[model samples]
Structures are given as structure tokens and as C-alpha cells.
Target: MSTTTTTTTKQGHPPGLYLLFATEMWERFSYYGMRAIFVLYLTQALLLDKNVATDDYYGSYTGLVYLTPLIGGYVSDRYWGNRRSILVGGLIMALGQLLMFISASFYQNFSVSHNVMLLGLLALIVGNGFFKPNISTMVGQLYPEGDSRRDSAYTIFYMGINLGAFFSPIICGFLGDTGNPADFRWGFLAACAGMVVSIITFELLKNKYLITPEGGAIGGTPEKVAQIEDNTPKRSISENIGWAIGALVLAVAFFYGANIDLIGSFIFSLSIIAPLYIILDKSLNREEKERISVIYIAAFFVIAFWAAFEQAGTSLTFFADEQTDRVVFGKEIPASAFNSINAIFIVLLAPIISIIWVQLAKKGLEPASPAKQAFGLLFLSIGYLVIAFGVKDLNPNVKVSIMWLTSLYFLHTIGELCLSPISLSMVNKLAPPRFAALLMGVWFLSTAAANKLSGTLGALYPDEKLIAAGKIPSIFGFQITNLYEFFMVFVVFAGVASLCLFLLSFRMKKMMHGRG
Candidate 1:
């Protein structure tokens, strides 16, 4: 029973590892930069109205963004090889970013032209489908299987993501929304520039990192002579044609999700899940089935967590806008600015937490996997409670200060630090090697599903406002007219899910059969 682990001594592996880090850093700068403004632009600048269309837009955008990584991951693992796939994905995404800039420009001219916006959105969704998975896969390939540093590597990688997200809102939000079109142009340009910067850095370092993964390029310009996997599936023309139709049909279904309600959304999600489930069920062995079962179960708990957690972008943002007082030392800040708090917290706390996890793991005092996840959920739930307390304290005429919101964000960030990245690493490690990337895809599919639900939950609160504030719709027959009431329900949901996971951990561990 040899259990030898791979090690990447500080000087070991290629110097290019850090280059990829830098590349990823800039790409995040582009992504979060755009994300910070996308919603604001839609509601405020473009005036699309916030109720149904807004959540749909967010759900569709974020869900599809996550879902495409499956296609990207499979293309890399089975056909393109990681490096080539990464390059292709990066270039595609870069083009998409420029297209998005064009979109903003068109928006400036046409204001509410749906066609331009749709095209830009399509470009981004498609481009992200290619980029996200490939880049993460590249990071994993930088180390051997079971590498001790892999967790740290991902932490570092995640940090790169957060650091960019942390700054993008501050900079892009400032520039893009700086009371003039000139500032907006600079913001969009900064996004495009950051992506290009990342792409160039990636290209330079591609060769060095290729030292171990040892595969030739697979995708770039259509002209380049690149190698494909020798056994890349040679589907018959009829089968390929059938798949094309199936994909089109599936795309149509999800595209409709942009306009439909929970029923339509659920139908679309089930369309993806049902077929995949039947295939996995019918094809895999007992052990494999059980392993995937854990993954799926984990998926549900994740949905529970994300439904609560994702309120940060939607419901929480709205709360900050209407209810929470934004007086930071007597000067008011925009509600959207609070959205940056979680990323900022991550940038500051991630390294310290990562080090603690590593040290604890080495000492055998690290909490078991399920417990950690449960802990994350607990914090998230508690965070909502913390905010609710602030609401309780405010006088009829007086408002709570920004510090309370920041405090709540700190708790949610702690929960996120515990749950999110840990889950990614867990998926990569626990999945059977043969189906590694696909399992990762399934993992992200969970994210896709969870995100869609997150949007719905944003709309799911009570109208505590009309009853409590003015004429506003309740999310779930409850008057969300009050920010505290809306957020508290989600927080409570997360806490309950955490407790359930905690109680079930021992049973789940038994089923894991030591695989975890």
C-alpha cells in the first residue's frame, strides 16, 4: 500500500509557474472588472428594470459562464492538451473582452439596443466556456498527481483570482462609473488591456511549463501544425450531426432561461442533469457510482450554500442600496461598492488561512473535509444573523453604519474561504483519474445550478418593505421591502444546511470508504 506523494520543492518545477500566476492575475483583473459594472450598467445606465430581467440576466450570464468550462475541460483533457487549449481559450476570451468593450460603446450610442448587448454577452459566455477550465487544468498539470503543493498551488491560484476581483471593482467601478463617458472608456480599455497582458504572459511561459506535461500544442490559429490526441474520438458523421442538433436544442432551452421563471429554469437545468445522470448511472461500476454519488450529494449541499452565499451579488446588493446606511466616516459610498468587500477580505485573509490549513494538515489536526464544509455553512448562516441584529438596533429615523455591513461581509468571506476553493481541490483529488476533468465539470455544473438558484433566491424574499418600507414585491410572500429580512432567511438556510452536513458527516465518511 504505497502512498507516496509528489513534492514541488521551492526550487523545483518550472519558473513559468509564477508566470502563469501573473497571467491569471491580469485575466481576473479583466473579468471582475467587467463583472463589477455589468449589472450596474444594465439597471442604471441601460435602465432594464431590476425585478425579473435583472436576476435572469445575472443567472444566465454566471450560469453559462460556469457551464462552458465543462466543454473546455473535456476538450483539453481528451483532445487539445492543456497548454494549447489554454492558449486557444485565452485568445477567444480576449476577443470576447474586446467585443464586450464594443458592447459598452454601442450601449453608449444605442442605449438599450438588445442585439449588441446580446452579441457581446454571447461572445463572453462562449469565450469563458473555453478559458476557465483550461487555465485551472494547466495549474494542476504544473504539479504531479498527489503533489503536496497542489493545494497551496490552487490557493495561490485562487488568490490571484481574488486579488484581481478585489481591485477590478475599485478601479473599473471608479473609472467606468466616474460620472463621464471618458472614464467609462478607460475602464473598458483597462479590462481589455489586462486580458491582453495575461495572454502575452501565458504565451511566454507556455514552453517552460511544458517541460513535464510533455504534450505538443493542440489549438491555436487554424493554420498552426499542432498534434491532437492519437485516440481523439472519431465520431461518425451521423453521430456528430446528431450531437450538433442535440447541442443546438440544449442551447435553445438554456437561452430561453433568460426570460422564464423557476419552472422554465428548472426544466432547463433538469435537461442537463437527467441525461448526464442516466449516462453515469448506466455506465459506471459500483465503486465509481458511489464516488460520483458523493459528488452529486456534495452538489446539493453546495446549492444550499451558494443560494445563501450568492445573495452578496443580488439581494445583498439591493439591501445596501435601499436599506443599509452607507456613511463611511460621514461620506456616503455607493451600494455597489460594498460588493467589493468580500474579494478584499479574501485577498487579505487567504494566504494566512492557507498557511494554517497546510500547517494543520501536516500536524494531523486539520478538521475532516465534511466538517470544514459544514463550518463554512455555519459561518454564512451566522453572518446573516449578524446583519439582522444590526437592523434590529436601528432607530425608526436612524440607519446602521457601513461597519455592520463590513462585519457581515467578513463572516461570509470566512465561510467562502472555508468552502469554495476547498471544494474544487476536493473534486480534483477525489475523482477517479480517468474521469478527472469530467468530474470537475460536474462539480462546476453544480455551481451553474447553484448560481441559477441564487438568482431566484434574490427574488425570493418577503415584501417587508411595503409593509415595512414602500410599494415593493415580496420574494417568497415575505416583505423583502426590508433588507434585513431578505438576507436573514438565506443566512438561516445556510446554517441549517451546515448543521445537516455536520450531523451527516460520519455517515458520508463511511460511504466515502476512505477515498476522501
Candidate 2:
């Protein structure tokens, strides 16, 4: 119940920040390492059709991964609390990675391997629901209210995420993506090991460092919820259940009407309904409603950004594997290894961006969070534009320079620097303390929608085989005959979304009151 600020070091941040950093780093290592090779495993080892692999399985798995965070966030807010949720989630994810290792190990036995892989994906999706939101919410708790350092702290935390991501592809790709199906188990096993390390680190450190500035434990059980009085009217348990059932019915109706697959429908529907449910709560005042509306609005725009950015694991990997000139110094780079490029760029640039934000704050020149995200979308569009031009007029059979793809990732990294961490900090700043973890989950819900769309777009990757089969690839009725057009799809989506968000940024900032 103490109101004192948490202790800090010479670095101007709490020591617990590093602890959470290490924990999140290893979890991302586990997740990204497995992801770096998942598509390849489906296409090469399992010999599934590329479209089916990306559009159905890969998209569903990744989308569901983000979707389940809603459940985890709600559970943490209502019952388990952040620390316990993280531990449980980390353990399940480790098991999921271990199952993936088994799945890769049994690749020769197609049925067993495929079934086990599905089970593994399920575990990971559920586990991530618990782990992802809680960890992010805790980052904000490390600082007291009105702390200007929060944004910089998130940027530093984001660096840890990228640091793990940077290494995962290199290490996992080296071990598993060596053109031999039998070797993938080693990469998955490495991911499993990373998850185990993450769990152990959190268990050892949470009590010691993961605390509020006032020396109170952060993310404790519901019994230890913050002592701040709530004047808002509380909903009855029956009313909450009624809302849940109503949302489920609406989601099912959307699934049938949307013509997309079941998982996609569920993700997209919940992304909309979940936030509406929160906003409609009778307990929220006018100010809280406006702030939450800003979160929802930003989340809507974020969908477009992630839908385009997430292609790294799908269509982009295909480009690297088949169209890019990967040979260098007499060795061929694994397609999965290219996934590390964005991560490496983030590692190199996060500190600089962090400094830039801090300096801008000092001068009172800092853009509102929404404006930063608008610039993010702009950078993303430009990244795609760069690659679109790079591939224009190039022969289908001829590989382009690796520099083209490298340049695209560089711009996307800048876009991510602008948006992702800023959004996290914004949610932390704007969310009611009682709803902190749940609101973070709501933010990730946008990512779930984006990832699902990423898979759908990835399926449109203009494969020659599909074209030869008379199945022309298109999005919204426009044909994608080659890489040029495919890349432009992203350019247009991000560009339009960026311009629109920029125009609305001022209004959204006003909704934040003085918090902006």
C-alpha cells in the first residue's frame, strides 16, 4: 500500500527492468527460434502445399497465439495475477517447444509428427496468452504514475525482445534449417531449453526485484489488488457471463458470414467485441471511456501495420528461399535466417531511439504516442515501396540481390521502433490500474487480427505452381502476377493507413487529456 517510488540504479531505471528483460528475452528466443523455421518445416519436411501451410496452419497458429492473450489477460486481472501467470505460461511454452522437437524428430512418420505439432502449437498459443500480456503490463508497473522514464524503459525492454529475436534465427536456422529435415529437432530443442531458462530466471528473481517503487510486490494475486478505491459500479457475475455468451454468439455469426476460416473469424470478431465490452462497462467514467477509446482506435490502426509486418515468416521467407540470391562466400544462407535481420536492426537502433525519445522529452518536442505510431506506418509503407521497386521488372526466374530484402527489413525495423514500444507505453499510461493486464491483452488483440491477415496475405504470395494450376493469386480482385505486385499490396495498405492515422493523431491525443 506504500506510495513511495521503486528504487533505481545509476542507469535511471529500476534493476527489476533487467530481470524482466532477461525473462522476456529468453521467452522470445523460444518463440522466435521456433517460428524462424516453422514454415520451412511444413513445406520441406512435411511437404505440404505452401498456400495451405501459410494460409491455414501457419496463419491460424500465429493468430491464435495472439488471440489467447485475451484469455490470459482476463485471468491474470481476475484471478492468477501477473507473476503466477508468467510462470505458468512459460512452463507451458517450454513444453510446447519440447513437443515441437518431438514433432520434428518424428518427421519420417508423417501422421504422428503432424498431430504432435498441432498439439504443440495449441500449448504455445494458450501459454503465450498467459505470458505475453502479463510481462508487458509488469514493465509499466516498474515505474510510478507520471514517470517520464516509462517510454524509455519500454524501449530498453523492447531491446531485450529484439536481442533474443536477433539470435534465435541465426542459432535455430543454423541447427535446423540446413536443408535436412532430420536436423530441425535440434533447433526446436534449443528453443525448449531457452523457455526453461526463462522460467527458472523468473522464479528466482520475481520476489527479489519485481516490485513497485513503493516496495510492494507487483502483479500479486487478486487478494492483493491495489488499495485505490473504486467508485464505479461493479457488474454482477451473472451480467459478466451474459456478456460473454453474447459475444460468443456474435462471433459465431461473424464466422459464418465472413467466409474466412473459423480461427480467423474468431480472432477478428473478438478483437472488435472484446474492446466494445470493456468500453460499455457502466462503471467507467467519461474520462476513462475517452482514454480507453484512444487505445481501441490505435489498436485498429495497428492491425494494418502488423498484417503487413508479419509477412517476414511467410511470403518473405519464400522470397528469401526461392527468389533472393542467398549465396555468399560459397555458402547459401538459410531462408529462416533472414528473419533475424529485423531483430538485429532493432538491437542496433533501439538504444538510439530510446535516447531520441528522452532528448525529445527534455525539449518538449516529443510527439504524442499516436503520432509516433503514424510515423511507424509511414516507415513501413516506405519499406515495402523500396522492395517493390527493387523487384519490379525482374525476371521471375532470376534472383535479386539480398540487399533489396535487407533494405526492406531496415525500414520495417524503424517502423516497429516507432509503433510497438510506444503503443505498449501508451497502454500502460492510459489504462486503469485494475484493468492493466486486460487492456494490454486488448492491445495484443489487434496484433492477433494483423497476424491472421498476414497469413491470408502470405497465401497470396503468387506461387508459380498455383498459377500454373490456374489458381490466380489476388487480393480484393487485383491480380498479383509477381513479387512486384505482391510487395505493393503492403505498400498501399500501410501508406493509406499511415496517412489516415496521421490526420487523426491530433484528435486521439486530445482524448488522452494531459497524458499525451
Candidate 3:
């Protein structure tokens, strides 16, 4: 069996890291730019109801976006490989963006526009499935096993992701989210251009830079490499099929019992099933299974974190639009631009956070990955708590100071710094080489569930019209009559999840077998 090797660099990291960084930056720019205006375009241009747009359309779209990575990962592991999958996915996404531009151009004809937009979204979801996991998995391959710089490298890569995210909303929102609906096409066009840049950048540079230390090309087709054989006894095909069938039945039951829509139920079901399938692989020994278990456990906790954090795209965006004071130096800021705050904070703070991790590492005092993630959930809860208090006792018609929303974003950025990149690095460190991309896809599966839940929670946003009609929104038996109660819901979810993960961190650290 052969394994990938890492190159030494005077800058403390390989040059390939920077190449991947620039590639991912533009990809994120395309993704976040389109996302910044998706809901606004649906509601304002297509004139869909808020709840319908968020719960049915946006939830389903984003959920599927994450869900299909399972298929992409499997295909990559068996056939396409990372480089080919990324190129194909990028081209597809670029086409998706062009379709969106056309959809926005035809916004006046709702039926035509809606159908075309759906097709475009389908393209984006499928493309992202191929693109997301492969790129992330490649980042881990850039370093050898147990390298101290791995975590810091991921943090730096995360900053690249945010750099793109930070500018996208400002540019996209400025072009598309102006009061007039006709301008949405310009935003989609810009996103299309970003995707094109991403594709070209990767294609031009990958052969030169995406290589192992010995100058062997990385992420080549799986068949081209000599692989370690998994000789452990495996489940019979019939038995495996039986398990899959059982999982599907449970998914349907959940759909009906939980009253979540089809997409939500599907995402939630696969989030569990996919991880279980990987764990059941007969090739994994006791230690490998335990380490993988930690990934699954942390992923479960992450669902809670992102369900709250992702409100930035839906409920939080609504709050910024309707409730926050957006006036700045005598001009009103576009609500969609508020999406940039978290990303901008990430760009500013990621370096400091990266430095802290390195400094702590040198002294053998760095917190374990699980402990760091718990702190992330804690900060997320605190962020919501701050906004909950700000919204307390306020009249529905009266706008609160923008500072409240900014504070929430600032805190959430800290939480994101703690959790998101760490989880990515954790998956990379803990995953076996053969299962690398597949496990990355499983990690994203949790995000699929969270994004769906975010939409479900976003639907619970207290609409003033609904409140006036004497119909208050509720979740898990708690009534949300106002913005304060709504915000508190997240506070409770994240706080409880943080506590639970904290208690489990000690055990999970032991499971890692000293890897962290």
C-alpha cells in the first residue's frame, strides 16, 4: 500500500495550499453570490409567500445541494476522481448560473421563470455535490499524517472561503437586491462570471501544483493508484440491500410523523444512514471505528450549531430587512448586504484564531477538537441571547439599532471559527485514506440536515400579519409570538447541544487515539 506525502516549504505550508485556496475562493464567491439573493429573488420577483419560499423552496434546494454529495463522493472514490469531478461540477454550475440569469430576465412571467429557475437550481445542486466534497478532501491530502500544520492550514483555507463570501453579498446584493426586481439578472450574471473564473483557475493550475511531495499527481483516478486491500469479512449484498430498504421505510415514517416535508425527512434520514453505512464497513478495525464514531458524534452536534447559524440566509435576513435600522450616513443599506458581516468578520479574525491555535499547540495546551467545537456552540448560543434581549419588549413596527444584529454576527463568526474549519480538519485527520472523500461527504450530510432545519425554523419567524390574525407560530410546543421568542429558540438549542458535546468531549478525545 502506498500513501501520499507532503512537501516542505519555507512559508510553513506547501505551494499547493495556495493554489487550492485561490480556486476555492472564486467557487465560494459564485456560491455565496447566488445564495445572497436566492430567497429575495423568489419572494420579490416570483412573488412567492415568505413561508412557502423559505420552507418549501429554499429548504428543499439547499438540502438537496448537500444531499447529492453522497453520490458524488462514491463516484469519485470509484471512478471520476477529484480533479475530473471538480472540473465537470464547475462547468455544470456555471451553466446553472447562466440559467439563473435567464430566469431572472424572465421574472415578469412567473410560471416560465419559476420552472426555468428550478432547472437551474437542480444543476447547481448536482454540481455542488461533485464540487464540495472533492475540494475539501484534497486539502487534507496536501499534508502527511499527524502534521501539526494541518489544522492551521485548514484555518487558512477557511479564510479563503470567507474572503469570497465577504465580497459576494456586497456585490450581488448591490446589483440584484435593489428595490426594483428587474436588476436581479445582473447579480446572477456576476455569479456566472465568478464560476467561470473558478473553473479556469483550477484547470490552468491543477496539473502544475496539485501534486504529492514526490511529484506524483494527486486525486488521479482511483484505478491508477495501488490501494491497500480491505480483507475483512463484509456483509452480504442482500443484507446490505435489506438495511437500505429499512432506512427508506424509516425515512417515510419520519416524514409523516414529524410533519416535516419530503425533502426535510430525506435529508435527516440520510444524515444518519450514510454515517452508519460507513461505520459498518467491515474493513475498519476497532480503533478506526472509534475514531469514525467521534466524527459522527460531532456531526450530530453540528446539526444544532448550523441550524442556528444558517439563519443568516433566511430568518436573520428578514430581521435585517424589516426590524434592523439599516440607515447609514443618510442612505439605507440593502438588507442582503448584511449577509456579508459574518464573512467579513471571518476574514479579519481567522488569522488571529489561526495564530492562537499554533501558539497553543507549541505549548501542548491546545484544546482538543471536540472541546473547541463545544466552545463554538457556546458562542452561537451567546450570539442569539444577545439579539433575544435586544428584541425583547420592542414594538413590531419599531426598528432596533443595527448594532444588535452586528453583535450577533460578530459572535456567530467566532463560533464559526471554532467549529466549521476544525470539523473539516478533524474529518481529514480521522478519516482513512481510501474513505477520504466519502467521509467528507458524510460530514456534509449533517450540514444538509441543518440547512433543512434552518428553513423549518425560518418558517417559524413571527410574521406580523399572522400575529395580527391571532395565529402565533410554535416549534416543539413553544409559541413564538415575537422576534425575542424566536431568537431564544436558537439560544436553547445551541446551549443544550453545547453542554452535551462538552460532556462527551473527554470520551471522544480518547477515541481519537492521540491523533488530535
As a TM-score, model 1 comes out at 0.83
**Tens digits of lDDT, candidate 2, 1-516:** 422333343248988999999999999999899999999999999999999999898899999999998899999988899999999999999999999999999999999999999999999999999999999999988887898788888998999999899999999999999999999999999999999999999999899999877777988886644343245577789988987787788778877876878888788778878998888878678999999999999999999999999999999999999999999999989999999999999998888887897788889998999999999999999999999999999888999999999999999999999999999999999998778889999999999989999999999998898899899898788998888899999999999999999999999999999887
> Please, what is the TM-score per model?
0.83, 0.96, 0.96
User: How many clashes would you count in candidate 3?
Assistant: 0
Instruction: Give the clashing residue pairs of candidate 3, or none.
Output: none
CA lDDT, every prediction?
0.67, 0.91, 0.89
- Model 3 weakest lDDT span, ten residues long: 1-10
- List residue ranges in candidate 2 displaced over 4 A: 1-11, 224-232
Model 1 local distance difference test score: 0.67
Candidate 3 lDDT (Cα, whole model)? Answer: 0.89
How would you encode candidate 1's per-residue C-alpha lDDT over 1-516 as one tens digit per residue? 122222234335445457667878888888778776666666665556554544677766766666666776666556665567666767777777777676666565654445666666677766666677666655665665666667677777788788877887778777776544434545666777888888898887666554443333322332221223222344468865665566556655665746556433543464365335423533355766666666666767877887677777766666676667876677767665676899889988998888888888789888766667888899988888988888864544566667778998999889888887777676666665445555676677667777777776766543343355556656447655455666677777897899888887676666665655
Cα lDDT tens digits, model 3, 153-240, are 8998998899899898899999999989999999999999999999999999999989865677888898642245334465789988
lDDT top scorer: 2
Candidate 1 regions exceeding 4 Å error are 1-16, 108-112, 179-185, 213-284, 322-334, 393-399, 460-472, 475-477, 513-515
